[model samples]
Target chain A: MSDILPPGSVIGILGGGQLGRMLSVAAARLGYLTHIYEPAANPPAGHVADRVTTASYEDADSLRAFAASVDVITYEFENVPTAALDLLEAAKPIRPNRRALAVSQDRIAEKDFLTGLGLTCAPYAAVSDMDSLQAAIAQVGTPAILKTTRLGYDGKGQARLRSADDAGAALADMNGAPAVLEGFISFTHEVSVIAARGLDGAVSCYDPGENVHKDGILHTTTLPANLSLAQRTDAVLLAARILNALDYVGVMGVELFVTPKGLIVNEIAPRVHNSGHWTQNGCAVDQFEQHIRAVAGWPLGDGSRHSDVVMENLIGDDILRVPQIATEKHAALHLYGKHEARPGRKMGHVNRVTPK
Target chain B: MSDILPPGSVIGILGGGQLGRMLSVAAARLGYLTHIYEPAANPPAGHVADRVTTASYEDADSLRAFAASVDVITYEFENVPTAALDLLEAAKPIRPNRRALAVSQDRIAEKDFLTGLGLTCAPYAAVSDMDSLQAAIAQVGTPAILKTTRLGYDGKGQARLRSADDAGAALADMNGAPAVLEGFISFTHEVSVIAARGLDGAVSCYDPGENVHKDGILHTTTLPANLSLAQRTDAVLLAARILNALDYVGVMGVELFVTPKGLIVNEIAPRVHNSGHWTQNGCAVDQFEQHIRAVAGWPLGDGSRHSDVVMENLIGDDILRVPQIATEKHAALHLYGKHEARPGRKMGHVNRVTPK
Candidate 1:
């Protein structure tokens, strides 16, 4: 193939979750075949992928063979083991590169990187022990949250400290791992910018989506987020800056806390985010297709929103409401082919679009 | 699974062409796994399907296994062999039913069925020999088309009869098989209704899309087709009538020739039609998904159009223009993972939506 991977080229994806399932479908839309690598048998993406290698990331032989079978590599999750990345990167190009992954993998590193770019985030300090925890509590104040520095998601590995007395209990929740103490910021709502940068360095950002989380999990993401024109511009620009700084090639989700002062950077995900699911119905080109186009060295498609959309995640028992949702007008239901609907597990999502 | 085939249920699809490829993707969106049965190795649908059985329709063991592995059976094409259908129907429920398939498989039968329902169709006569050919020419005048009663698609197995003198040549073109002679209707344009019927006998129809054909292949399908309010209502009602008459349980494409007399039935496809491809961008529930929902015993989704869309097929060498189309705003491309683009082959299509 030339600079652009032609149709029929294999796109290898790591982690065959719902995001990967949608990505594989998007890859197929662009005439590219996707090979999914996941340890779980009958992973959701495996249902749509051209091939699936059911082997752990530590399986070097499988990893090597997987790398040899595709043109480029991309991923659904950011917590891939470093050694697996080292092996895959040696064989094929990996989009959103390792540095992007490293920064997002650790809380302190991510906050430091965002602050280094002059972006505003919550006041935070690293804590490795009780002495450091006491110092962090004093510096960041009593109403703060203690979070593990790495491998944390969906509010897991986190504890709230109502006061200095709760610091001891919150710090104990971290076990022996290092953590970050983040002072609580009074925010009205949360919004995220789903942005992308192509291999050619062209950047594109979708309209910001307002997010609502329940039980520390995303509940719904609505388009036309409640934001002033200036706030919207700021969200897109800051997201673009992060992508440019990392030389990222793929879609990235940058969550922000909209406070009274301005938008505060919450965290960044180096892959397509759940908050961006509304684009599947609101935009001409969805995030999954946009990421595939970027990593495949093709031109980025238009990401302009055409309709107002409310994307509600069908977590666990929310799938039971599908029959009711199916009868509703303008509701597009997308369900992952997971056998069990365990509590807190994402079963599916519905994108409800308003008619023009 | 109750009345509905729950998530992770297998759906077996026969014929692995572009239609099957899209249907497979739609099935995945609804958390249903698809197994493709095709005689050819490396069929397009196989790239995204959960499994593929590369055996001929006549292979009884393969067909048995394919049927045994799925809750329901459906097809992308109408001309599946009789013996294959008999074996498959014995093992699993086939959507649209065998009667719908039988009527659509033969041109004369389709016309007769349409006329039997008090629907208007072009004057037609069946021809099996020279005497019958002459009789058909007398019944259906000059400027007619002689087409094989069975196994005709994409303008294949057809010949144009300009006058009475061309009858012998047109009959010879049938190769001693059965044929139908249709009197030409002077029409302003061709339009189609993509309608669906659920297992519960409920029917839904998308807005009429006007179609333009080139070289006997569908060239483009534009939404909000040129039709009066009354005509649009009539088009949908007639399509629903046909589906109900056949006791159909899936999406059907009804082609109508807009004539001075009224809408004349050009043809009807038992499955998703190329004319309905615009639904992919214009509507919330596309034809593929509607068909999947109907076959899976799920409620049919809303088929309301949300945007104006013009869908153009990328035939053969037209695939080269993808790079250019990829950069266009509001153009949604869907390509079949076919390796080669031979002349007259439909490699993919681009649905261009007008900004809302």
Candidate 2:
């Protein structure tokens, strides 16, 4: 067992987007100072963090000083450069570990790890070149998704293979980068369970949230997903299996395709998930605070939902509706403080609470 | 009546205590930037705010600069110097207004104002000097408390005159400062109502929280206080009446003594009260966020409680229980991140939720 850091200890966060911003806020609530190490200028997380180091991941001196200043380090995203982790891990412990990052950073490796645990996932094959793409298509078949193995999110670095004839086109989309071809899922709906694994190895999973995506961007997440009690229990157990398998030390978003046969794992995010944002207004212990508690080695809090909430993403022009949403009695507006509201950018979200 | 400031506008907070710190966090949630103007170095609020100006309130140049930088100003306390308000009000609007500060700054004026509004309070008389103190004591009778008219809080500047013989010594305890003698109220318990008003004259009030004080310092605030439906209705009405009377644009905490016959207004704080901290875990929109929304000219959110909560202050060494409390299910720790834990200092608080 490791010594739990009391108040006044600094937590180093590797990303400065909205997820990191919220994590810093949660850390501060628990009496911990946050040092945000983000390469981007004027990061949203820096607005609430105690200190912000503006330097690239390649800046070894800056990374070293940041690591030295903090008692523990955690990243808001899985794509943190391995080199930066190499520098920071030598100075301080990184929660969630590099093994989880390595598996998540590669599609083929992630599927292999999941299958090794006897978990069900979509059919996928490694596509290294045109020949591999053709071979993988012959196995996984058409109506699949071709995606880069690393550094892709929000539907980026991906192409859809509608038919066998589109194989060459999909290969062209990869541009020689290592890619993944996943067979299309005939899921009734998509759901995600946000699970946290404590340093003590205790796992807690929040109720799954049913998600709706528009143009591959999350549109809304409705709580109490239309699933039977048995499905809910199965989803949670599968999520815990993933967390335990990874030896995860923080919150993980496990996206699943709910089908007639059972639940099929879609993808996993090593940080707070956008689909779980409804917990901010629906549960007493939110995902952000849960993540902070897990990273800080504190006990996992109650993740039970107190209120039914429907969360809607405020993307680009959706912000214009804030004037109306702000007046809605049960709607809690959560803005990210982002200056520009460009299309597809997650400016903020509003959680509308409904009485149970 | 006025335009609500957009999200990115800066909010200037006047105090640097835990209240300000929580306020800054709340402002950030609403997508507003906070700039803390505190006289003390490394103020708790500064750790979360986007900017901090550490200069004495008496410093005219710093005060001017702080006011100019923010779109609107609101304070975390009622005792701001009149001269400072005079300078800041010329640059930007200070919420809760000067009338609130003037009335709350002087105990005599506060009592007069409350009585003028036909509110019932304990028998009291102002003591300008020793002769007046003697006369006030004779009128208010024995077992009365003598408190300084200005700069008194948390049982700090008050002395209990238990008997007639203790009058001279109690008067001497005032140290020649103006004071008030009040006949102690015989009440079953103390409850406080946190109410807010908006720019368009809208009002919202949270349920009353019953408070217990130890050594005149707040010990705990238990929600769903033992009160008849009529008493609850009266509490909300009285609180709304006070807000409407002041044309208040922020949250106010109204403390009342529950007597056998009816409720008697004890005193009021022009800002968020310690008694209302339970809202952090009990309600969807907490007192801090309510204050921010009102000051920002945004529409008020629902202030209804979602769960029963008991909030206990982590004063001084009480923080030592944080490790144990962190493991307690449904207990949410909210620490101020103060560097030192001095005696009687409010280091943080724990909001224990009762799953009703």
Candidate 3:
């Protein structure tokens, strides 16, 4: 790729979800143009982007056209098909690389990559067949999870293996697709470190945020996540180490479990994550903007927080309460332009800032 | 008019300037779509809006189509042609109403309306001919200004009369258009109150900002304008009174001259003003979002300030210094995506915030 793309260069976004919407806003704020390529008609990101191309991701013709129009391509979700990535890579530079995407696309590869970096992870083994499932269960013991290694988000594509007997049916239900069996850890809390790595190899991480999930979806995130200064420093260093090892050139979110021993790696998302939304109201620059800067080859902003912040997601019909939230003196409300209030769908988020 | 327009409802914007661009961002934040209609092909607001229609205000067919595509219409600049407004008003609601626009579109009418409400203004008289100009000059005396009554802004279409003998040439230069001759007020400082009036009759104002102008364009605005407690209260009260009188349903900027006697009304913009740019970083709800809320029939946001702020305009080549300005811990940089940085053009703004 060229040394650095200018500010006016167009950045192509793959998925038109809320993350894409915010990324477009951030990109525009930095004097960069965004062109959204999403298969779905009327994707939310199209509202603020410079242009929108509505076509199926697997349509090679459309993908090529979209790729030709942009200087670099990035995606909001990790589940993009490898074939789609191949087509885009042939046309323009793709950041975070296809290798990072492949490593993060499945649970097994992700865990192995982290473990290879001398990072702690929950004990896990891959299961390809029923016999292998039983062997994996024997190795990791019962009371583990059997999760499909691909196309899973929130709580989908996973089942709990209460006992060894349930492993056979779980594997059968998987239909012989690759899966991972992992032992559950008793984590005190869940936290995530959102960090960005520039093309020039500079990395910076925001303060870790303690996250709470309801039904496998993030409910809220509170910053200064009650960690010791040592723990916080360790979490940031771990995230930076992962970004460097991967040669990542954009924002990466690393989810960690605070166990009795220390922080254990849970998963890594190669895009802006929901846990860092508080930065929109509390910090000088937000995660989305930081990601744009990193991808656009600009200098990273000081990701320092001006205040303590709490971000609460407005899921489904929870958006109707925005009026009450808007009345707060320190609250900043952001609502996505989703027409349907479908259950479990993220509708918006609100950030409340308190002076440090 | 409907109490609430749905998410996909198109909002027609009258003038495609920087205020319109910021308003489009705010509208997109609320999930309402924006359609920009401007005579200029490459309007600033068009860069980010969903659609752009380039046609003259006199083109009824284009105006009809633009009005028909959107549920409601609003303006960025106050000097919208009355005929175009009539066409738009025939189709949908024109917010802040044409009456406020009419009052503000003319300098003499604005002063008369404010003074009719028992408010103080510099002495002024209408001049339609050379005789009237001489008589008005005799009354207001020298060192006053002779300004065309219509379609004037940012120190344009106005000439300073240094002596009584220059009144005839000034009036002749007006080219038979209606004009206003106003007595000059020696002021210690110039300040403005950015206030919003909700559809439900709620009025809220940010703290008045002391302004400094250079070369007929605003250079900087500093909040907490060295005003005493009584003066601040009076400024807020004046803004509220103007909103109530106009029955305004959006953000209106009231500029005042801080004279020896008291605060005198200078002019009013029936739309968001440049003076409120500080709110984008200093207040909980910025003027753009406040204007959006007022027009959408939503409850007004808390306009409380979190910090003392100074906002500097980045005109023309000043935008090239964004990188240097971005390094400041307290400065938030905002750039308008205008493709060309012409001389004296408002390219962007930066706000420096400090704790009150």
- Reference-based TM-score of each model: 0.99, 0.98, 0.96
Question: On residues A1-356, what C-alpha lDDT tens digit does candidate 3 reach at each position?
Answer: 24557656899999999899999888877777889999899888888888999998789999999999999999899998889999999989888778789999999999999999999999999999987888898899879999899988888888889999787778877777899999988899999999999878889898899999998899999987978888899899999989999999899989999987999999999999999998887676789988988888777777877778899999998977776786677888887788888999999998887776
Candidate of highest TM-score? 1
Which parts of model 1 are misplaced by more than 4 Å?
Answer: none
| Chain B vs. true chain B: TM-score per candidate | 0.99, 0.98, 0.97
lDDT of 3 by residue, B1-356 (tens): 24656666888888888888889888888778899999987776775788889999999999999999998899998877888899889999999888899999988889989998989988898999988888898899889999999997778878889998787778877888999999998889899999999888989999899999988899999987978888899999998999999899999998899977899998899999999999987766789989988888777887888778899999998987877776577777777777788888898998887677
Tell me which of candidates 2 and 3 scores higher on lDDT: 2
| Ranking according to lDDT, highest score first | 1, 2, 3
The lDDT of each candidate is 0.94, 0.90, 0.87
lDDT of 1 at A28: 93
Please report how far candidate 3 places residue B174 from its true position, in Å: 2.7
| Per-residue error (Å), model 3, residue B265 | 1.6
Per-chain TM-score of chain A in candidate 3 equals 0.97
Candidate 1 clashing pairs, residues 3+ apart or interchain: none
The sequence of per-residue lDDT tens digits that candidate 1 reaches over residues B1-356 is 25788788999999999999999999999989999999999999999999999999889999999999998999999989999999999999998799999999989989999999999999999989989888898898988999999999899999999988987888889999999988998999999999999999999999999999999899999988999998999999999999999999999999999987789999999999899898888878899999999999999998899999999999999999999999999999999989999999999999999854
Residue pairs in candidate 2 whose N, alpha carbon or C atoms collide under 3 angstroms: none
Whole-model alpha-carbon lDDT for candidate 3: 0.87
- For residue A72, model 2's alpha carbon misses the true position, in angstroms, by 0.8
At residue B269, give the lDDT of candidate 1: 94
